[model samples]
Target chain A: MTQIVRTPHEGPRAASAKRPGRSAVSRRSVTLITGCVLSGMILLLALVSLFWTPYAPDDTSGGRLTGPGAGHLLGTDKLGRDLFTQLMTGSRIAVEAGLGSVLIAAVAGVTLGVLAAFAQGWLDDTLSAFLDILIAFPTLLLAMLIVAARSATLGSAVLAIGLAQSAVVARVVRILVKRVLAQDYITAARTSGTSWPRIVAGHVLPNIWPTLVVNLALQFGLAVLAEAGLSYLGLGAPPPNASWGRMLQEAQATFTTAPAGALAPGVLLVLLVIGVNLVADGLRDTLDPATGRRRS
Target chain B: MTLLDIRGLTIRTTDGHTLVDDLSLTIAGGERRGLIGESGSGKSLTTLAVLGLLPDGMTATGSIELAGTQIVGAREKHLTRVRGTDAAIVFQEPLTALDPLMRVGRQIAEPLARRRGLKGAELQRAVARALEQVRLPEPDRIARAFPHEISGGQRQRVALAMALACEPKLLIADEPTTALDVSVQADMLDLIDTLVRERDMAVLFVSHDLAVVARVTDRVLVMKDGRAVEEGDVREIVRRPREEYTAALVASARRLESALDTRRAR
Candidate 1:
């Protein structure tokens, strides 16, 4: 017998050493940290807003079109409601919409994608074609159609955005599943007497999860942006909820006198989206094995 | 008793082009048999046919009986049951054969759990034991490591461990050592040889290297163009190949061995 000797502790160190060069590693970490911090700040603001804001989000106690002062940090809206309070509440709605839509997209989209990948012959062709048609339909248009069909409520907005986003998720998942299935390990799994369901749960999912996770992160940002767009169109969360999109719409008429009303929500939305995108890029760099890190 | 009997096996594409035509072979219990040929000679397809794992758009006809269970035309459900229990296969590329994301132990334990119902401590023990059987060092550590964490030779051994974990009556190894370094290849063949004898498992060893086949197998079948050109005892065939194709294979093996010998002499 040939003796095989290896130190278990060396395994992890060796793996880390094989990662990309120092500069690349630092860059990825910086992006990841910055994204986390930015998103965390907004999430914190949203969570804190659950109990208290400077004033009630819909309270128009301050004089209409008032500028920033000790009493009104971001000034008052056209209706004299606290802009700062509205921005905080808007963060809560944005996060909720992003999370809810992504949940729907991940579950429904991954299922459809896996199905399309596994289905053979006509079924696969049909599902692929159907997804193609859905993809061709613009996301905003689809959300509008669904929102128009249903009442303009938070649930409807979430459903509309999620349904529109699922097609994109499904298409991505299909390609990923196809790539995984074509690998020799899949063939090995089949020959090992592992059933298709077991193989999917055991081998396929684990292999594709990292990539799917990065994609879902990107989708979360898009979902938030989509929800904001819908709300701007008066189809998102109804009044009193104070989503950023709706706040933007309401602030449009007062842009010249009290620009803080529009600027606060708009900046927060952009920051949230940018933070999420940066996180996705960082995740892609770390999770993908192809981008090997070189040790100095 | 014959561990595996394949008769009149014919695999053809959807367009009706024959990839493997009318090949027949058998392996008795605990026998080590080899099928040797160059690439595209249908050696791999013949083994795949036995497992009912031929790729899409290809169909196999005739009978493949594994321990008296008919495999051809069998339902996928039934074939699945027979696969890990009655026969298992190891492939050419170990890197690709094993799941990159999974720990080696989990991959080995999967068959043991599904086929033998081994669980918990027993399952871990079985996985470690399988690794030990393949002569891998530090079974526990190796088990925890991912496929990519280990060396190529170690990965191939892990693949062998998985195939042999269930202690199947028949093990089909399709060029299992072809991807390994030459120095590692000899040890791999020796390990397979020792394990097959110890477990009394019949192995259907397929390779393009004549010398490799001769080392591990007692009976050798030389194939060309999807057909078995010659079959006989290893020594007899190596010494006096009857068919022209078999003769060419034997000659090549001799020339390679001599070339290695000359380098050693220097």
Candidate 2:
């Protein structure tokens, strides 16, 4: 019944109240803001693609393998589909797969990690061993296993990547939870009649969230990459569901004729990954003011 | 009258290592006793056993009767009820004992609201009163501030205030002042003394320093390794040494005090 109101991230006023003159703080904010812009651009592109993409995602009216010109913005793919339109469509899939897989990882990993934190002796050992084994399995191999077991589709591919990556998230959460539990404040809370659930929500969750968030953000970028790899291997979402990886796979054949097709998606993919990583690093600074001084 | 009674308590680690051996002690209502020992001497474990809050992979086998409730081997549901009502503990490191994320007022308000059923506005007033009781200046501001925002001494005061908010019959202080600045140690000890006397509450003060034990406790139990080496009246133990271990502890405390005194004599 007790509600614990916590600001997930501090507002601008609080951030400013800190020593804003510090170069380190400014640098992190710059990185964070830039990452936001990059991610926001893709998000906007995807949303716009939803309503209008200049041409249908599969439109092949334009001649095949055309270079950038007045009519074709970024040129045209082998199928004569508008390359810009396909890239726009690819952005939506990237965001969806990134978000969907991260959601799966966060929910599954946090639960398992917290449970392991609370577990003792045999249960704890078994869970830790299992998590390690899962983490050792490559994302592609896991995706292949899932695809073999079920039908290959976008959902299944995201599931495979998420399930594979969840072990990493769980491992991080377990360590964070254990550290939080060791703090004397946890004992103090217990002695003051706080229940376990309340302690987990109020103490354990809030204390470990900054690290957890950073881990999840990193996991997001990896999920996108894994999905792209899966798509390239012909295991991801089928046709009509154009992916940056699929686009890159198609472009490899006609690289000499139209390098834009390959360069466009490849650069965008790398940019998205780097942008997410920058945000994760920046978030490590911004969300954790208490540890900021020590880290900086 | 025997509010806190521990009989033949033994703590064993998972690998069959004994931490505390056959420890027996009792405190009547309003009586204060000190459990003195160096690090890893099992004094802290003894205190933890009183609340059934021992670490995982460690087991306590003995009777811990606190406010008429059996603590050892008690179910968590029952232990939860006894804790904060029968006894509350203030750990050594006060700065880390209070939640870094929570405002001090809300930290104190939890027990007040839970045990006393105090509502919103009323809970706020009680939190302010608790802070004032700790003699913290500008109670409102201190209540509003986070643990790191205040000094170590202030955080200890807040911790003491939280423990007292539940009005438990017994207060277990495990080296409470050890982590404070030297100047604030006296203030913290005095605060505990005054608050306990005002409530007529029993206290189990655990510390390694003989002088600290002498300052607040009526009786003292000297522990070495995992066994109780000596136990007697604080004045008697300090004046007439019965065991070599207790004598060494006394000699060290005397040396420390005289070193300070001789320097001041100049």
DockQ of all candidate complexes: 0.51, 0.37
Q: After superposition, how far is residue A194 of candidate 1 from its true place, in Å?
A: 0.8
Give lDDT tens digits, candidate 1, residues B28-55.
9989999999999999999888889888
In model 2, the number of clashes is: 0
lDDT of each: 0.87, 0.88
The residue-level lDDT of candidate 2 at B18 comes to 97
Report, for candidate 1, the interface RMSD: 4.1
Measured against the true structure, the TM-scores of the candidates, in listed sequence, are: 0.95, 0.93
Point out where model 2 deviates above 4 Å: A1-21
Question: What would the per-residue lDDT of candidate 2 be over residues A47-83, giving only the tens digit for each residue?
Answer: 9988999888878999999999889899999889999
- The residue-level lDDT of candidate 1 at A63 comes to 86
> Which residue pairs in candidate 1 collide?
A19-A293, A19-A294, A20-A293, A20-A294
Candidate 1 similarity to native, TM-score: 0.95
Docking class of 2: acceptable
